[model samples]
Target: MTATRVILIRHGRTTWNASARFQGQTDVPLDDVGVGQAQRTADALYQELVGTDVRILSSDLSRAAQTARALATKLHVEVGLDERLREISAGEWEGLTRDEIVKGWGDDYDAWRRGDVELRLGGNGETRNEAAERCASAIVEAEKAMDSGTLVCVGHGGALRGAIFSLLGTPAWPWHAMEGLRNAHWAELQYTGQGWRLSRYNVN
Candidate 1:
């Protein structure tokens, strides 16, 4: 079977992420520790992907773009930004800390934790299904363009999980069961002519 490999990398932690805030759609910069994490990830990818032809892709957001840039530089390749790879829109919860969200939007926050896609945070936000569809479409497009080499996509944690689960044909709702992905963590996938298959998930 013809197989194409894809590497899904989560962006480094942002300032809001360090503060345990809901960072969806918020343009936050990476903290010092996050920068270090990105550097280390770049180094690892450099060693692992040397002399291999790989297409580099990342979310349009700055945080993910920055992390992708690091890897692209190490691999000497240009990075491509895909809007479909953006994070889930968190609406009014964007910059709010966990405790602050609990205090301000208690019931909604609880429902979110319970994986209720219908539960809107504040007034408007991208539901889990919406995020999954976008991410999955991006993956399909990437797979079609990739022939024999690797395709590296750097995106947000939530969106990355959504993409992985969607590719696995799992429900988007119960995202919590998918486990949290650390900054700079990676998920490896192999795509056959039929579809993509997961080889690993959340590897740092």
Candidate 2:
């Protein structure tokens, strides 16, 4: 079987990110600093990913899509936007800060961090398991669609990390064992006979 190589990138910073807002699937745009980050990381990734059959896929949200566009342009390819790659919906938590969450939903937040995958943080929000499933499904289907190539998937922090956890065959209890990605940083993985293996994490 052809190896399914993947470069999983976290989208660049948005105004919400800088402001420490929840963001979620609120469709925030990248900020000025984020634009520079995208360009710089695109240059770096273009060099790193050269000579591969590259296909770019991004979350339909503006922040992620913008990041994908920058990197895809550098690689001379059009970005494929997919709504499934979007951030987990925060529902009522959207636009709130971490401190705000702590103040308002302290017990709920703590319980969630303590491995309550079924606990929904906000009204009409997704559980951790649900978010992981959506993220993982997108990657799995996309991998099946491509015979061979590097799949550069750009998405938000929460959703991207959820996908990683799901792909690793780990339970949500150990979620914090894997740290979240910095803006524009990427993790590289390859599907092989042995299954998916993480080659590196947080490479810029």
Compare the candidates by lDDT and give the number of the best one.
2
Which residue pairs does candidate 1 place in steric collision?
A: none
Q: Write the per-residue lDDT of candidate 1 for residues 1-204, one digit (tens) a residue.
A: 232888999999888888898888888878888888888999988888989878898899998999999999888899999999999998988888888888988888888888886665655888877887798788778767765678899898887887787887776547678787899889998877566688888787
For candidate 2, list the clashing residue pairs, or say none.
Answer: none
Model 2 per-residue lDDT tens digits across residues 69-96: 9988877898998888988887788899
CA lDDT of each prediction against the hidden true structure: 0.83, 0.84
Which runs of model 1 end up more than 4 angstroms from their true locations?
1-3
Residue 97 in candidate 1 has what lDDT? 86
